[model samples]
Target: MVDRKKSPKKTRNLEESRKEILEAAFWEIFTRSFQGVSVDDIVGKTSLTKGAFYHQFPTKLDLGYALVDEVIKPMTYSRWIDPLKEYENPIEGILAQLKNLIGKAKPSELRYGCPLNNLVQEMAPVDKGFKERLENALNYWIDGMEKELKRAKEGGYLKKDVNTRQAAHFVVMAHEGFYGMLKALDDPKAFDALYDSLKRYFATIRS
Candidate 1:
């Protein structure tokens, strides 16, 4: 007879573990504001152990920063920035992206609100690190929009007097505000009304 000992379970690789933690934290933070969810709450959602979590993210704050850099930044680029490249008129691109987002949005998303906006409201004021990271993400979005708007202006798709920088900022503000209102009202009709109003606004800026 051989002495029998239990075999230790194989652990996930570092990148895989890190990704799991970030994904779990993202959903938790998205639904329940970042301040509302504890580290345990995030870890509980993943199969990884506390040690595994710490190995990937030294602190909860670090995890939040990583979440913004890794998940939110890429998401913003993919959803808002990349789509604008396809249209000569940035206004048309912006409207098309908004329509696609509204068409594909889930009830939970409408209820929880935009993830980047949620973090900005919750963490930006109190935490310096969060403020910097969130500000950078917002600037990335604004810069991308500004670049496209500039292109449109050069191509004569936008009004001669249109200020691309200010217009880009306004678009970001309105886009974030749209989700905030939806989250507050929990009304689909509000989305349709707001969308139509945005279309009218876009028309005013076009050549």
Candidate 2:
């Protein structure tokens, strides 16, 4: 018979180790770019040895994909998707979300830009596996915005003729473009202008 107490503790410890490895990999890849960061760099950030790291991730590519699937996807969902649910005004919710993101930004975030956008630009053209996974994450962002916009239109927050598909596409493009420019210029103040532009764009969508 299984010892229920010991078995649950063992499972919890294993899961914790797996999460620790992914957390290490996430920051390493974010700072160095996924292609530039080696497995050794990630292991160096954690207490786990090479063997323990390999036991959890099996290979570098697996760790990268897990970072995309488990860590990054959930972060984006919480930041960009979850708050939109049950919101009375899609435009206000979106604008508030952007402002919240900007409020939390640091100099380092502006310098490195978003990890998702970084991978999309660097790996999409050359790497199929990375491209597919990155695209899935991007689609999740776009689709969530598209859904909220559609709800707003249906509920009379948007103009009767507003095209939600285009609106959603514009939002994703603007955000990605803003982050790319911010990273290239290493200027957090650039968000002020971008925020103003975004506000004007949101104003146009109001009923």
For all candidates, the clash counts are: 0, 0
Estimate TM-scores for all models: 0.90, 0.91
Mind sharing the TM-score for model 1?
Answer: 0.90
Which number leads on lDDT? 1
lDDT of 2 by residue, 94-140 (tens): 77777778545887767888888888888788888888999999888
- Alpha-carbon runs more than 4 Å astray in model 1: 1-12
Q: Measured by TM-score, how close is model 2 to the native structure?
A: 0.91
Clashing pairs in 1: none
Q: Write the per-residue lDDT of candidate 1 for residues 1-207, one digit (tens) a residue.
A: 643342222233667788889999999999888889999999999998998898888899999999999999889889998989998777788888887896458777688888999999989999999999999999999999999999999999889899989999999998998889988988867888888888888789888
Please report how far candidate 2 places residue 44 from its true position, in Å.
1.3
